[model samples]
Every structure is written in structure tokens, then in C-alpha cells.
Target: MSKGQQWDVVSGVGITALAVAAARAVETGRPDALIEDPYARGFVGAARAPVKLPTTPAEAEAADGRGYWAQVSTYIAVRTRAFDDYFRQAAEAGVTQAVLLASGLDTRAFRLPWPERTVVYEIDQPLVLDFKLTVLREHGATAGGVHRPVGADLREDWPAALEAAGFDRARPTAWLAEGLLPYLPSEAEESLFHEIHRLSAPGSRLAVEAIGNIPGALADTAANGSVRTLGVDLADLIHTGQRPAPADRLTNLGWNVRTVPATETAAEHGRPLSPAFVERDARYVFADRPPRAIASSAMSSVIRPPV
Candidate 1:
């Protein structure tokens, strides 16, 4: 489905963002959590619709099912930690500019201990970003870096919006597209990377969490009954089937790419492993645009997905 002209906290793909916030809030409450997002709980609290956070395996099962939701929670927790490390490494390497594409409820701009001179630009639907900012403001949350929010649809001219919001394309940037691509059609996904390749300066780092083909459990409407109880369908939100390979695109764009299995990341963090992790084509990919000269040109646009 194409993105609508507008969306709120509980409609379309926006609702999935709330679910992700819920997962993050629950994870932050964990004693052995890989990352702590203090704003996550507040975001959930401020949501227009009730968000059922999975603070424990029991809560997860109650929200979805005995096994599937538990696995989803573990997967989210693992994904959060891995992406956190990606930003840290980028900062340690002296890349001060960060761009979060389809940022959703991500609070990395406020939570992570960013190096001095770091500037983070978040790009997403206008209302989604507005809701997040409103909650953070109400809770008196402070940012760790220069946080700039660009309210624009990714399907449109978001790069222009980003540039207007003080994103410097000349500097190396740390870019993230987590839990995002599966919603876009294959052609849109490819066009997205093409834009990223054009906008990235050498030494830029990119991280993504994606599934080549959505898992049967998440794609099965009947199986996701527990998720439906909360008024959000995990399966319905996702655009399933084959899609563009981001790694291959980045490689052709002169970036060095590395991919790690989601299960391996979970194992490294000492988290539980489930078939959901090992029995799927899920992966966390990292690609770095090397410190070299880049061609000064804008990429030609391809056909946009059917609107």
C-alpha cells in the first residue's frame, strides 16, 4: 500500500511505530538491557491509543502469543543494541553527522552519548515526528546532540527537507533505516538507496535491519491474533515478498558492506534464540562509504511505486 498524505499515532504504518516504541520502553525497563531509552516509556504513555509493552517474556506472550511475540520482543531488543553500537562506532571514527531515515520513534538523538559536534537529523512523516516531539517536550527530555526534525514523506523530496533542516552533505554521515524497508515496495526500496548513495559523502556509515522475506508468523494474520487484540496487525503492516538487496546496491555505489545474521547478534548479547531468528531471512546490515572522492552528481530518479 502507498503511504497516505497524512497519518497519526494510530493509523497506517504509524501504528507500527507505536508498537516499536512499546517494545523499546519494555526493553529499557529490563535490568540486563543492551540499551536504555528513557523517553520510550513516556512516548508510550503519551500515545493516543494504549500501547502494550512487552517488559518480560510473559508480557510478550500475553500480548501476542506464547512463542511468536516472545521471539519478536527478543528480536527487537537485539536489533536495538546492534544499531546503537553502529552509531557509537561511527562517532568514535569522528563522523559527526547522522541521518535517521524513516526514524519513527527512535530516541537515539536524545539517549546516546554523542561526541561533541554531532548533529542528528530525523526524517519521517510530519505527524509522526510531531507526536514524538510533543511527548519528549512534555517529559522534559534533553538531547545528546543537535537534534533536527525534518517532517517530510520519504516517498517525496525528503532530501531537500533534510538539507533545509541543516543536514550537511559534505561531511560523513551515519545513516540508519531500521524496521523501514519492508513497508516499501521493491522499486521504492531501490530508489531509496539510490537517493542515499547520491546524498552520502565518503566515510558515511549506514545500518539497516531488514527481512528479505517477512517471516510466516509476522505475515500470518491468523497467527498474529494476539497482536490484533491491541488494534494493530503486524502482518498487515508489512509489504511481503521479494525486494531489492540493499547490500548489493551499496556495494555498487562504492560502499563496503557487511551483513550479520539477526540470530548471531542476539547470541552475542546473550539473548534467547528462537526459530524466528534462525528460521528466517532476517539480517542486520552495515555499509560504510569509504573516505574517497565521490562523483558530484544527483542520481536519476527511477519509476516511483504505484501511488
Candidate 2:
């Protein structure tokens, strides 16, 4: 991927964002929905997707049976619910600041019940952010808290842009990297986390949707299927290679980390996913930095008393 490549809501990586919204819309209509995103369908309706994107369960059923869309819809629902809970838990823990990296078409700031005086920063390409704000504004949506959009490339110096936009590094933050890592090159992924670590304060938390390594054959098959069905070549957009696990990287950076397999999460949510659609190695990684007092106490305990 180029350093400053751009795409709108209907093309490139941007279409994937719309696809997720469509999945959310379908999930919202379920009687036993994991998360309610009333605005998800609106985003889908506004975009002119190159292929038929299902916004309802019936439409989704017609697209493919027990196929790509089926697995994606279920997985997206599970992933959305998991991240939603992560944010809620962070809020309950009194960490009021939040950042959504590559925050495309996600309506959390508008739908999630955030505490008063909370601030949410969304970082993405300028066009992507503009498109999202336009669609939401047309629907007369209001954010639950202070909403700031940082329009900059993640591969560039976004931390400076974030700081300029009043991101408080000293305050505990709840950061999310949902469905973003795969589009980033290996080096860029490393840089992204390093920046996150630098800006995060003690007591901050992070949640990531991490993908496991994909075999070349599987990758080619998936990519070919997507192009044939969706009219978009996902292979061109995705960066595939062996990289360090996000959980291990965060642990080494002094964050308490936990990894949960996507299949396990699906079962826990009572929605078992098909392995064909969901990557066998896909997982969610949640990590939190220790508060300063706890770190200080631990350091003190390790030191012997002066003779």
C-alpha cells in the first residue's frame, strides 16, 4: 500500500467499511441482536456499492447461503458486540477518553452511551471521515459525547495531528483498532502500535481485531472469490505476511494482555461461526496498562530495604 493512498465509501478499503455497516444493519434487525445500530442501514443506503450489499436478513439470505456474507455477518455481529462491551467496560472503569483508529463508518460515538464530558477521537483518511460525517449529519445524528475527527493518514505522523486536535496523552484512553491491521503493511503495523504505546497513559486500554497468518492458497482463493462476487479485488488492498502477534507486542510494551479466539468468542456469544468464513486463527486482543500507583508499588516491592 502506498503511504498516502485514499478511497471513498464505495471503493478500495472504503467498501469494506460499508460492508461492515451492512452487517451491523442486519444484526440490528435481529430479535436477539447483540448490538443495535439504527444508523447502519442508512450508511449502506447512502453508498452506491459496486455489488449488491445486503442490509436486511432476507436480503443477506438471498445473497449467499452459508457462504462469505453469512460468515461475515455473524462474525461482524460478534466482533461488534465484543468491542462495544470493551468500550462500556472502559467507561465504567472511569477512562473517559477514546480513540478509534481507522474508524470507518462506525457509529459508536453516536450510538454508544458514553459518560458526560467524554471525548471520542476518530482517525482516518480525510475523505473517509468526510463521507461518514456527511452521512450522519444528513440523518440528524448527535454524538453521545465530544466527537473529534482527525483527518490524516495512519502511515504518516497522526500522533501529532491527534495531539493538535486536543488528544490528551496524559489521560487514560480507550483505543480501538477494529478491522484495521490487515490493510496495513507489517512495518506500518509496528509503527502504529509504537505510536499508540507512546500516547497512551497509565490505566489506558486497547482492543484489537487481530488476524492470524493466512496461507497463500487460502489467501488467493478468498481474494478471487471476493473479486468474482463483489467486483473489488481485496487482494490488492490487503497486506499479507508473517508478523509478530499483537498480543505479544503489547505485553512486551508493559500492557497486561489477553487473547481470545474468534471461535471461542462466537461460542460464548451463542453464535457459533463457520470456520470457512472466519479465519481459524482470528482473535481479539485486549490489553490495559497498569495505573501509575500499581506500577510504583510493584517497583518499590522489588527493591530491597536499605541496610
Candidate 3:
């Protein structure tokens, strides 16, 4: 991994910036909040330089200081909170091992309290992991349980990288695909999860998030933001084996699947979104891996701490 520098490359800087902004919004106490992530504040402090806002005046203006970026930040914040709640609830339900794929700027392993022997693995590009490590060390933040940082790309030989870093696939895992899929190519995602299913043991759990309908009718506000639709096919991003059906999707691929709504989870967790946000239909989901049907463990995925 590159030495301590930028943790987020790709559009991840945008995503990380959104995550940071969302953390700020949630801390500010928005009424439509889905979950609370107090730890997000630290990532702002971790930055050694000022963040570069978007180039165009409209984009820049909307990106920050309470405009378009503010709206994007709020959506990202609510999503973060809901996903955190999902993982936390999954942990409480007894899932042990966790691997956070593309663990960009996420602080879950440190902020989330876990079972005594819980082990967390974080996978991301080398430089990304290195940057996070530097910030976390400076801030004196540590992983809640046994934490391992596996610096590698999901599109590469991350499986070997993880195994070298002490990942044990036999344990039940709670997988998190938060704020990552949209950046990847459709073909890469298939290879990615094919490995995930291959390495996953029985009783593993999976939680996923992805880009939603960006058509104006779906979310007019979302269209005004710096975000892009990720321009990938839904079937590849959602399910490769099952067609379009949610209930039968994961089951066809060896896991029990349930699609949870961002709006619903928000309300259930006491953070109600405005009707406008719901009408936008930003996509998010929660799924659990059932016991392996055909046994052939291939590889799983990473986790990260606050920067």
C-alpha cells in the first residue's frame, strides 16, 4: 500500500466526502435520520489538507455550505445510519465475523462494539488503507475487537491478500457492501461476490447498498447533486443468478435474501425521511447468508476504522 496519503481515490473522495457530510448532518440532528454515527466527526479532523469542492460554481455551491451537497450529504448520512443499524442488529443476532468490502472511509470496526472474539477485516486499495491507518493512529482510535486491515482491490487477488492477513472464512460473517458498488464495473461485481460466496461459510450474513433510480420522477432532489447513477445493470449489481425477483434472488445463489427499504428502515429506527426522499427511491438492502448448500469456500471481503 502507498504511504499515508489520500485514503479515497476513484469517486470515493466524493463518497467519503458525502459520508463525512452526512455524519455532520446526522450529528446536527436531522428529523429524518435513520441512525446516529457520532464517530464520523473524526474523519474530518484526520484530513491533512482542505477538501477540493467540485469545479463548477453550481456544483461547488451545491456541494457544500448548505446547498446541493447538503442534500446529498443528508441522503448519505441517513443511509449510513440505517446500514449501521443493520450491521449492529445483525451482530446482536449472533453473526460474528465481518468483512467490509471496499472499506473506504468507513469507521464501523472502531465505532461498533462487537462480541468478545469478533474479528473484523477491512479491504481496500493499498493507499486508501494506508491513509486511514495514519489518521486512526494519530487519533488514537483502535478497532473494537480483533481488527485486520487487508489492503487490496476487490478486482484483484484480494482473497490471497486477506488470507495472508489472517482472515478465516469458516466463521459466520456479517458482510457490509456500504457505499461501494456503484463505483465498480458490472463485470467486476460478479467476480467479486462470486468469490464472496465461494469463501463464505454457512450462516454468513450479507448487507448491501447500491445506486437507485435517478430519473427525476424518482428523486428530483437527488438529480441536483454531485452524485451519478453508477450506470451499471441492476441484475449484475443486485443479483446474478435470480432474474428480478428479490425474494428468490439470493436463495438461488445460496443465501437467504430480504430486501429492506431505506425509507422503512429509517422510520423503524426513528428517522423518518421526508416524502420527497422516499419518492426518490434511493436503493438499499439487507440480506443474510444461509448455511452453504454446495461447499467450496473461495474468498470473502474487508472492514475499516475511522480515519
Candidate 4:
């Protein structure tokens, strides 16, 4: 990916962000869908990118054909539902301040019925944020709570930008880093977690989609097949280098952590495991920072549970 300062709908890693929206739009149309994003289809239509969203069963069949796209759709569906539930659970626990890092065409800020006094800060590229808000406004969709769009790159001084956008770092915050890790280099990924830990107050929570190692042949098929079919090569955009374990890092940072495999998440949601399961290395992680008293207590044991 180019290190350009600007990107629109179809260019660079920004296209992959739209690609995820396309997947979500397809999933929302399914009768037994795991999650629903009412704004996803609109974003797809508005984008200049040739992002294909399967609106009919035949179109879906032709697009997937029991191959890479099929698995990609299934994985995204499961991932979307899991993260949706994570935010809802976090919000219910009275954590009002929320931030969606690398938020690309995500409609949770407008869709989720949040509690009073809730504020959601969405951080993403300037063009990405502008395009999303423009499309959303054209569709006449209203936000569910306070939605703050902080236009800044993750590699830049984003924390300062987020604070300037009215983010209160002093309060307990719920942070979502969905579909962000793989694109970052190993060192940058480390820096991202460290920054998150630095800004997090006691009782803060985090949700992540951790990337794992995939088998060689399966990876090759996905790189060739899924990439061309979707008009976005996620494999090419992502870094395959070894990354520090997210759960381990969070645990060492004095956070209570839980990790779950995508396969288990699929089974729990009654979705079929992707046929390319052998090649896909994906896991969901949830971490919570304990309150001051709990962190100081000797009985503070990290809670590890399968989602």
C-alpha cells in the first residue's frame, strides 16, 4: 500500500474498508443473518469503487461458488455479530465513552441504540470519514447518539486529534479495533496497543480481531481467488510478519483478557465454518481494565473465557 496522505473509496487500503462493508451488506440480506447493518448497502451504492454486494441468492451463489468468497462472507458475518454484541455488552455495563478505531463505513454509531450521555468517536482517514458521512446524510439516517468523526491517520498524532474532537480520556472508554491489526506492521501494532493502554482509564474495555498464521496453500488460493473476485486483495494489503500477542500484551498491561476462535463463534451463531478454515487464522479478543481497587487487590485474576 502507498503511504499517500489521501485516499478515496477505491484506492489503497481504503478499498478493503469498503470491501468489508460490501460483506456486511450481503450478510444483512440473509434470512438467518447473524447481524444487520441497515446503512451498509447504501454505502456500497454510494461508493465510486466497484464494490459488489450480493443482493440475491443466485448472485451470492455465483459470487461465492463454495470457495473463497463464501468463507470470507461467513467469517465477516460472524465477526460482525461478535463485535456488535461486544459493544452492546460494554455499553450495558455503563461505559459511556466509546471509540471506533479505523472505523470504515461502520454504522454502529448511527444504528446502535445507546444509553444517555454516550459519546462515540470514530477515527479514520479524512477522505474515508467524509465519504461515509456524506453517503449517510444523503440516506437521511440519523445517529443514535453523539457521533464524533475524528479525521486522522492511525500513524499520525491521532490520540491528540481524538482528544481535540472532545474525547474524554479520563473516563472509562470502550474501544473497538475491528479489522485493523493485519494492515499495521509489527512495530506499529505494538505502538498501537501501547498507545491504547496509555490513554485507557481504569475500567476501560477493548475488543480486537487478532490475525493469526494461515497455511501456505490456502493462503495462496485466497490471495489469488478472493482478491480478484472482490476487487480488493486483502492478502496483499496485510502484513504477514509475526506480531506480539494482543491478549498477552493486554494481560501484561494489567487487563482482564478473553480470546475466542472464529470457528467457535461461527458454531455459536449457527453459521457454517468456512471451508477455508484450515488457512484462515482469525481470533476475537476482549480485554478489560480493572478499577483502581481491583487492580491493586491480590485476588485480581484475569478472566479468560471463550466467546
Ranking by lDDT: 2, 4, 1, 3
Writing each residue's lDDT as its tens digit, candidate 2 over 1-307 gives 4777778888788888888998899888778888899889998888888887888887887776645665678889999989999999999999899999999999999999999799999998888889899989999999998999999888888999999999999999999999899888888899999999999999999999987855642474475387655557777878778899999999999899999888888899899987564554678999998876646678888986798
Question: What is candidate 3's lDDT per residue for 116-168, written digit by digit as tens?
Answer: 68888988877667666776777788788788888877766778998898878
What's model 1's TM-score? Answer: 0.88
Candidate 2 Cα deviation (angstroms), residue 64: 3.0
Per-residue error for 178 in candidate 1, Å, reads 0.3
lDDT of 1 by residue, 39-98 (tens): 877876777664455545457667755565556556778898899899999999899999
Give residue 89's error in model 3 in angstroms: 2.7
Best model per lDDT:
2
**Distance from true location, Cα of 1 in model 2, Å:** 4.0
Model 4: lDDT equals: 0.80
State the C-alpha lDDT per candidate. 0.78, 0.86, 0.60, 0.80
How high a TM-score does candidate 2 get? 0.93
Give the lowest summed-lDDT range of ten residues in model 3.
231-240
- Tell me the deviation in Å of residue 282 in model 2: 1.4
Clashing pairs in 1: none
lDDT of 4 by residue, 1-307 (tens): 5553677667778887787787777788778888788888887788776546564335567775665555666788898889889999988999999999999888889888888679999998999999999999988888777889999878767899999999888999999999888777777788889899999999999999886664453375565565566566656777777667899999999999999988889988888675466346678999999887744345435654457
lDDT of 4 at 25: 79
Query: Which candidate number has the best TM-score?
Result: 2
